[model samples]
Target: MNTDSKKINTSRISISELMLPSHSNFSGKIHGGYILSLMDKIAFACASKYSGRYCVTASVDTVDFLSPIEVGELVTLKACVNYVGRSSMVVGIRVISQNIQTGKIKHSNSSYFTMVAKDDDGNTVAVPRPILTTLDEVRRFYDSLRRIKAKKEHMEDTNSFDHTSREALDRLSDYGAILTL
Candidate 1:
C-alpha cells in the first residue's frame, strides 16, 4: 500500500579507481580489505540515493573473490539496490578489474551488502520500497530474498545446535579435527 517506491535503475552506482602499490598486500595483489572499504562506500551511496535518507551498513551478506586484482589494473565497482525490506535494502555489488594496456577484463568479486536507512538522530527509518522494472531486477530481488532467508535460518540453527552433541562430535571426527575439549 506504500506509494513511496522507486525503480531499481534509480539506485545504481559505479566507481572506478586505479589499483596502486599502496592498495596492494604483501602478496603483490590488491588487498581484499581495500576492496571491501570501497564496496561499503558504494553500497551506502546506492542505498541512500534510493531511500532518500542516510544509510548505514547492517551487514555484508556475501563476498566472493573469483580473481586476484593486480596493482596496475583499473578496478571498477558497481552497486545496485537488489531488494528492499522496510528500513533495509540489499545492495548487490560487482567488482571488475581491467588491464588498461591489453583491454582484458576480469570479474574479480561479487558481494551483497545489507544497508539500513537511518534518521539524523541515528534511529532506523523506513526506506522506499524498490520497484522492479526488468526481469533482471526481479530476479535479483528474489535471489536476495532467498539468501536472506537462508542466512537467518542458518544463524538460528547455529545458535541452538549443540556443538558437543554425540552426532556433532562424530561429524567433527570426519573432518579430522583434534578436539582438545
Candidate 2:
C-alpha cells in the first residue's frame, strides 16, 4: 500500500442479527433477497456517512453466494464505501455467518452496491467521500472510476450513431438543439 494511502481512513460498519426464516428454503439457507435487503441497509448507511446525506441503492452489479447461513445463526454484514464519483458511491459488502452455538464464522456472500445521493427536491447531489486507505483500495477505486468514464464515453459513442447534420438541424427545429423529453 502507498504510505499516504495507508494513512487514510477506510472505516466500515458491521450489522449483526440479519434474520431469516428457518422454513424459508431448501438446505435451510438464508434467502438471497433477505441477504440483499441486509446489504442494501448496510450500503445505505455507508453511503450516508460518506455523503453526509440520504442515499439509495441505485444498482447491485452482482452477488455471489459462497456458502450458506443456517437459521438461528447470526449473520453479520460488513459494509464500506469503497469508491465515489459525482453524485454516486460504490459500497462493498461481505456477509459472514456465525453458528450461534459453536461460534464458527464462515464467509457467506459478497456484493458491490451502487448508491446515489439526492437533495430535498430529489435532484442528484455530489458529496465528498473517504480517501483511499491502501494501495489495493486506491487501485480498485481508480479502476472503477475509469470504468465509469469509459461507460460514459461508450454511451456517447453509441449515441453518435444517430448524430447527423440533418438530425442536428431537426434537433434545432425543436428548441435550438436541445433535447426535450
Candidate 3:
C-alpha cells in the first residue's frame, strides 16, 4: 500500500488502436462490448498504477456511447484516477474516434470504473488517496463523491421498495413493462 497520496495526473494513460472489421458488429459498427473491454483494461491499469497494487474492477458506474466508430477509424482511450477512497478509486475514461484521412474526431464514449486494490493474498488493501491539483481534478473528485452518495441512497430505496404494491404495479405501465402477475 502506498503511504503517500498520488497525483491524479501521475497515473494517466492513453492508448489508441485502429478499429478493424473484425471488431465490428452485425450493424457494421464497432462493437460496444469490445470498447467496454478496452475501457476495463485501461481502468485497471490506471487504478493499479495509482495505488501501486493489483486492482480489480468493482463496478462500472456509467458507459455512455455518444458516437459510432467506423471500422477504419483510430479509437483512443484515455484514463485517469478521478477519485480515491481508503481502498477504492474511480477511474474516469474518455474514448474518441478519429478518421485517419479526414482528421475528424468524435467523442465516442465516457465512463467511470470503480476499482478496488488487493493484496497478494487476494485481500482488499488500502489505496493511496488522489491529490487534486487543478479545478478540473477537484470537480471530478467531488462529482465522484456525489455519485457514491446517490448510489447508496438508491440501493437503500431499492431494498425498501415494494414492487408488489398496487402503486408500484400501477407504475409498470409507465415503463411499458407488461404486468402479467
Candidate 4:
C-alpha cells in the first residue's frame, strides 16, 4: 500500500449541464445513456484526481435512475472517491436535476464506478490512500467494503456452482424461463 494519502474533499468534484433536446430520448426526457456517460466522465475525473494517475473504468455498479429529467432542466453530478485499494478506487456519484423555473430539485440517479490506476507503461499503479473525515465518508467506505465482499462472493459462487445440474435446470421454470434443451 502506498503511504501517500489525501483528504477526501481534495478530489471531490461537481459539474452541471443544462439538458437540451438533443440529449433527450423519444419520450422527451433526458436519456439515461447520456446521464451514464456523464457519470463515467465524472468518475474518471474524480478517480484520476485522487490517484494522481490515469485511471480506467473497470466496472459500474448499481445505476438506479430515480427520476426523469426534463429537457430544460439543469442536471448536476457530484462525484467523490468512496474507497481505495492498492490500485483501484470506487467513485460514488449522485445525479440531481433542477427545474430552473420552479427551483425544484429531484435526485435522478446514483451509481458506483470502479476505476483502476495505471502508469505510463500501462501497468497498474498504487494510488494514494483517502483520508476520510466526515461520518458520511466513513459510511461510504464501509459500504464499499461490503459491496466488494459481495462481488467476490458472487464471483466465487458463480465459478463453483453447476449450472448444468438437473436441480438447477428444473428450477429454471420458477423464473419463467423455458429450457429448450
TM-score order of candidates, top first: 1, 4, 3, 2
**Per-model tally of clashing residue pairs:** 0, 0, 0, 0
lDDT of 3 by residue, 100-181 (tens): 9999999999999999999999999998777778999999999999999999999999999998899999999999999887
CA displacement after TM-score superposition, residue 9 of candidate 4 (Å): 1.8
Question: Per-residue CA lDDT of candidate 4, range 1-181, in tens?
Answer: 3469888777799999999999999999999999999999999999999999999999999888899999999999999999999999999999999999999999999999999999999999999878998999999999999999999999999999999999999999999999999
In model 3, which runs have C-alpha deviations exceeding 4 angstroms?
1-3, 174-178
Candidate 1: clashing residue pairs, number? 0
Candidate 2, 1-181: lDDT as tens digits: 4332222144378899945675247667777777887889999988887677789888886688898678888988988777777888878789999998898999998887889989888889976745665787787677667756776798788987665567665767676556563
Q: lDDT of each structure?
A: 0.93, 0.76, 0.93, 0.95
TM-score of each: 0.95, 0.71, 0.94, 0.95
Q: Write the per-residue lDDT of candidate 1 for residues 1-181, one digit (tens) a residue.
A: 3668778789989999999999999999999999999999999999999999999999997688999999999999999999999999999999999999999999999999999999999999988767788999999999998999999999999999998798898789789897777
Winner on TM-score between 2 and 4 is 4
Ranking of all predicted structures according to lDDT, beginning with the best and ending with the worst: 4, 1, 3, 2
Candidate 1 vs candidate 4: which has greater lDDT?
A: 4
lDDT over C-alpha atoms for residue 94 of model 3: 96
Worst 10 residues of 4 by lDDT: 1-10
The number of the candidate with the highest lDDT is 4
lDDT of model 4 at position 154: 96
